[model samples]
Target: MDDIMRAIFACIPGMRSPASPGGCLSAAFGGGDDDGEEGEGEGEDRISRLPDAVLSSIVSRLPVKDGARTAVLSPRWRRVWASTPLVLDDADLLPDDDGPQIFWRDVADAVSRVLAAHPGPFRCVRLTNACSYAGSRGAAALSRWLGVLAAKGVQELVLVFLHAWPVRVEPPADVLRVSSLRRLYLGLWRSFPDTEHLRPGADVFPNLVELGICRTDIKAKDLDRLLQCSPALETLAFVVSYNTQPNVRVRSRSLRCVLFWMSIAEELAVVVAPRLERLILWNGCPCTRRVRRDFRTRVKIGYTPELKVLGYLEPRIHVLEIANTVIEAGTKPSPGTMVPTVKVLAMKVRFGVRQEAKMLLSFLRCFPNVETLHIMSAEADEPTGKLNFKLKFWQDVAPVECLKAHIKKVVFKNFRGERSELAFLRFVLERAQILQTLVVVLTDGDGDHASQEELGNRLKPLIYSTHRASKCAEFFIFVRCGGTSWSFRTASDLSRSDPFDC
Candidate 1:
């Protein structure tokens, strides 16, 4: 158990020191015998020696089970959990055979006890448990706990109880109305008939800056009302849960950094924030066999002039990350619409046929100023076809004349020695007027491994082939992924210009 724990602890990113002995034993091995006085002393020794602030930080990130066990470590540790702020992360919460009523009852009881034991104002409170409990009793218990924390003047409150209780229980509006609440992350817990009943504009979170919600089923009117209430909100992130047929138009005046992640089913209608500097959207079809069934399907998308204001980086925005999506052929934006000012574009195209090449070429037309481009194969049953997609993609997208002027270098990692692949290198060599350097990264997956002798013999003819060969500054084919251990035979001297027998 200790060895297993040490292995796991070694994998902890950026953690230089060893894991706390108490935490390791408690989590990996069963809770060590604490029935006697000697056990109590051992627990106390682990708690008292460790830094309190470190312990607090560690406990906050851990699951409730692990965090609760720390309290049994020693007398000092017993009350530390209540004193330290709690960030209830429900990402790891999985359903069990135990009914919802019993589950939430236990959770609510534990939370209530902790809060009551330490009545001090907490730094933050995040409750994101989405379990279908039996009755409205569990919801009531949650509200009561939240009410207590609200009364205590908590700084950051994040209530995310999506699909937990069936009743349309309203959130503790009295707590949300508090001016002290700076960061609020409230997601949908229960269904609401109207925005007014939930008291949207009636309350104000004056100091609120950052708010995030996922799977929230707020209507257009309700969304507007909620936005109006938070006049000072700066960073707003929404991961749409439900697919509204017509799609809702989102407008935020004070929002600067907006992150919208929704399915392609919804219209991408969002009024461009004038003061917005960064807008990120994750909208693309899933990378699976399902896409093949949905191909050539024209989905309705909405846009407005407000989005066009930032002619450089709004509307569709920049820094795109689309995976396993086949963009319909013949779909082009308006004529005057110059591509947004894109700096870096990372795309994982799923389509295999010539259409994929055409789409790559099409997408590149929009990002004329793109400096770096990264493309990878998607996780599908079929392989990225035997064609020279990358070469074709680059040839069609990167105009020879323009590339020579702007593009500084070209790098092909998985370079197979196909005629098309060779033609790609030849094209770049012939076209790129200002091309300074060309890097070819080879892979052994292509075919049988050729020895260094065979490669040198093949290139021996190139020395006296033509003057174009001399212009090549660095024309060495990297072998076996090319690292420190890579052995390069000095086949012909670097200065040797003759192609004949050396």
Candidate 2:
């Protein structure tokens, strides 16, 4: 405090050196008078008087309590925050020693005050409450707050509640009754409400565009009803867990993106999304032995027609994530499985003794139009154990002829330029007729500098050699070791033709 005061005093002339920082002496002597004069009439009234609209904008950006605190700055700001437009974050509620009831009472009081203070409809309202007690007191309290906001016609509303205990609670029906609600994210953890308890002939959310839910138990029929209510919904995210069997089908015609990480009890009965562009399925549950055990009933993965991004559908999907997990079983799948016409396909397999070259080869045969293919191996203490089989799989799968004309680019990360890598390259060089460029990067593992250089040297010969290279072979090799050295673009004939001519 003394330092600041002294700095301000030093801004005046003849108080300190002429080259004082921020002209401390000049500021101290003239700053306050200039500011006072500006506040009254002449000089700069624009700079002096804070506009009500600007104050409201500033308050609107800040949370409830912070905006209210700004009132103490000056007399002009006394009623500014009151009508700034409420945007509350319910996570601001923490356990107080005053007991849960009092705590909730205070919270309700604050919300009521803020709502009363702000005249117009709130732009954003977020009410999230967690429960420690078995009874849903917090949820009940939150319902009242949401009801108030709904009445005010808030535009954006988010409600997330994670309960430590399972409690039966009914949602405030009035929240859905809000006509002005456009975007909503509602998530309930621990348990969910009874689906049969829904209000009859209710269709409330007509203006909602984006609906996101997490850790919620929504039955199929109930979900379908909910989707039906939100006819204008464009994007939907359902982070489902546990054995949630949603029997009711959900169809979103306006939806462009759909993310589902849940377990559907029955096989995908209604996997139809006509306008869906991106479909992300992160199946947390592994395929049951009941399903995989029946060799006759080969699990057929079904997806929407127009899906551009589809991944992480099943566990032990070794063909999907070759970089992390390894392939365990090597079963030759029957041919004639119709492959969906998708632009991008990413696959990885869990590593095991039996290599899945045949299975992968069969799978790759499905993707005739795949433009890019990426393959990686798992990192393990015993690299030789599972790696050898994986290497063999790569060797068998890498017959350039298999990827000819279709695949134009291939990227191999954690590449060491080993025999497996060389064999893969040989396959590319032989098969990919329209292959424009091939990139092999060496990433340092175990801080081995010698190994990094060895990998780099091994890649250089493969790229520069003119023995038997692909017609469109343009190689690029990058050796990245500890972020110090990077050698990208090992071989390229820039003078001959433009690399990116297409």
Candidate 3:
């Protein structure tokens, strides 16, 4: 409800101010008789002096039911809500009280009623009632509702299946006719439909700027076609549960950010996304099981000259390819291997794994302009052979350009008091010349919390944790998964500049 708004009238600046007696109301919904009308006028006034644009903004910011209820406030308010683009989420129509829970049919009926009541031009519509579609009408097709949405000129939409579990059904051929969509999220799908066989230039998402697909089994050819059709799509994201095709190649003209969660791409080549800024891969596994699973992915950089923030890359499994050359542990830093545009980088390393530990240097060498670095301390269960990048290994290795000059902040996550872990931290403490802050997030999920100073004093015995290299550098520690866990929203959010932290 909070983040669903797309701000249709953002240019209406200089029109908003504090509300008067009639401008702001918490519970008044135009209920008054003789005495109540007098009280409502003075206490819950409906004579808002705000401009039409500002009134729309205020109404859009409120909850769906409350925003609609503003119509009962005054004649002017009714006109404003009727003229403004509607932002409807079905959850609001469902009652929150414990008195006689409404059936799925009731909720669906209420949603239909609301949509019918509103005028044309829907800013956004989130339909979660689809998850209960089967329970309500027994495999009823959701295309009917989609048609209604299209006719209403919805600019943003969140569409989910009406069934409890996912089923791959060919949606109506005219589904893409919803050309007014600016942002679309297709949820609970086995895979996105391939429209390659459609008639030449049948229909494309001309206005679609942001797209999200969740619970999908993504295929390369289909994914490529989806991007091609949406020529104006700038942000493309996916949250796949079981990825069948591990090889994906992206070629988009308008894409700026691409994020993946709980997905696997054995070989992903960025064929061409000139304006691409952020490429993120997060969450190793799909379902949370007690046992381990393989989640290896390799990335090939082709023509993404604008990529800035990248990672959660596991060197133990991932292969980094720049243009044509595959970056290896012994590969010397050169223009071919470097990406000077990257300002923030994240990595996943099991310091215990000899092969994985050595590849970190080669990966770090690729991003020379990285200012903030995040490292996820992967759990090493198998007790791999002797660690390769210990204190001695780090001391003798060639200097990492970013560590010596550009790196200002470093965050070590899921820290456990292991010998190999301390050795890596010690090396960074001594080598990083201008390090600003070292934030360590402990994996003490056992429900115990410790302060930063206390943890630093405790670590002094195991590792002289030199008080950071730079005079301005400081150390911080926190417990309870302080913004460490991953989610589809976190992976794709543009508001949060650094998803590595919050």
Candidate 4:
């Protein structure tokens, strides 16, 4: 039976019998000699038969050390590994038991050897964990390695410092001149020097598209100069960094996305971005406990006519001011003035602060064309504060065109059944004439099945009784489970006898 199976397998297309010389199946089935021999009994190397591109792809996916080790496999693989793009990561080079000094030496040596041997076009070179340990000597070695990468035409470069100590390595000036560099990420570095020292008429990072600097001290003016240098830059991000300037101005015509998270800039101004699409600003500082409010950071958006999504603006933001008054008031724009043209807007609303709630109306007026509105409800931290989200306040404000015509969906996260919270939803239901869906995400306080049911019962009557302009508008109630996943149920699906059962 076994003989018959083998014969059948051999008869199949691209399959060979064990006795056939240099056959893939014979070698795979251990029918060939184990020793490295050039004899008649040897079967074909099936893996080596793969095309160079496919083999290169396989090596590229491996850790840099393992990828380079393919040289021992065979002559064909050796050539493929050498030509494949380098992805050197220091973490992969050193074992967990290795000390910092050993890690530094090994990583530096491996990177130098690979860069020296590889002939052309490195895809990416990532040197992490060794940056903090890479003192002046290591920095010099790194600088030389970078020069080699520049000659080889590297596309992506990432340097990460994992240790708490800052990396003292001042990146070589060649970093700015790397014509082939498209994406660059630098983290936990002491500082980046100002670009003012560049020779006159010199354009830095001409081809850079995405730049991210995290946990690094970079002066606002220097950062601005860097952006000015990269004419083709599209996405820029700064996270957990200290800025020397109080106000950072980003003026770029080609930029599309800007993300600032937990950054300590007093203010950020998007002076010009004609093609901008997304803007995200988040400050993770705990200002809830502070009595004085001096650390407030304001973001000013200017001349982004194509802007589509703007969000995660926390309560910490003093204001998201649009420099173009025409955009803010939704009036006809002067020839050169820019308007928001935003479709999706996400913001935090403090429930008990009447002034804050009124500010929401002002925001709604600014983005007159917004179709989706996401509101994160914030409760008063003090016990004596009264809930300020009164429906009357919204009634008194000028009607926002989007609420009546454009807004189709509204999401209220952290829904605690405070009077103000219900009032906010009630106002939306009454005003959003074309609304299609309303999603209410209950807080952890209502995590239990009974509490969820009770909250649902309370909201159902209030939503149903509210004068909704769109008869087709649907309501969805989401309850948190064990502070993790959310379970949702549609209002229409709930039974009349047991509305809370849903």
By TM-score, the best candidate is 3
Q: Is candidate 2 or candidate 4 better by TM-score?
A: 4
Give the worst 10-residue stretch by lDDT in candidate 3: 3-12
Global lDDT of each model? 0.45, 0.49, 0.69, 0.64
| Candidate 4: residue pairs that collide | 22-43, 22-44, 23-44, 352-388
How many clashes show up per model? 1, 30, 2, 4
Q: Flag regions of model 2 displaced more than 4 Å.
A: 1-57, 71-85, 93-105, 130-135, 138-140, 165-175, 190-203, 246-250, 261-270, 283-303, 313-336, 351-358, 373-402, 409-430, 435-502
262-312 per-residue lDDT for model 2 (tens digits): 333343332446665554444433323334432221123344466554433
Alpha-carbon error at 392 in model 2, in Å? 6.3
Q: Which tens-of-lDDT digit does each residue in 1-502 have in candidate 4?
A: 2332232222111111122221121233223233323345565556556688987876776666667767765666678888887766665667646455464566667667777887877887776645445544555766677788788888887765553444355555556767788888776566775577765334677788877776567776677678777878887877555444678788887788776654556677888888877776655433223424546667788778777777656543555566634222233333333344888787887777655665566667667788888787776664334534553555565667788788888878777788878888888888888888787877667358787667677787777687777766365434332232211111111122211112
TM-score, structure 1 vs. true: 0.56
Best by lDDT: 3
Native-referenced Cα lDDT, model 2: 0.49
TM-score, prediction 3: 0.80
Task: Give lDDT: candidate 1, residue 151.
Answer: 74
lDDT, candidate 1, 1-502, per-residue tens: 2332232122112211234533443322134444212342233434344576866777765555566667876655666666666554333233335565446545555566656755566666655443223124444665566667667777776665444345534454444555667676555544322456545555466777766554445567766776767767766655443433335455666665554543233343445445444444444312222334432312211222222111111122122222222233333433233234433333434434444544544554544454433332222335455666444544454452224444344444344443434444465455555455455544335344564334334433322342232244655432234222211111111222211111
User: Which tens-of-lDDT digit does each residue in 1-502 have in candidate 3?
Assistant: 1111111111011112333423445545445542224253454634354577977888876656777887876677788889888877776667767677568777777777777888767888877663345323433445566677788899888765533434444344455778888888765554566666744433478889888766555577767777777878888876553445767788988898887655555777788999998898765443424223564567888899999889888786678999788998878989988989998899999888777777888899889989999998888887687655554776687889999899888888877766778778877777788787777776654645554445455566534436456665354433333334555556566777777765
User: Whole-model lDDT for model 4 versus the true structure?
Assistant: 0.64
Ranking by lDDT: 3, 4, 2, 1
lDDT of model 1 at position 369: 52
Q: What is the lDDT of residue 387 in candidate 4?
A: 39
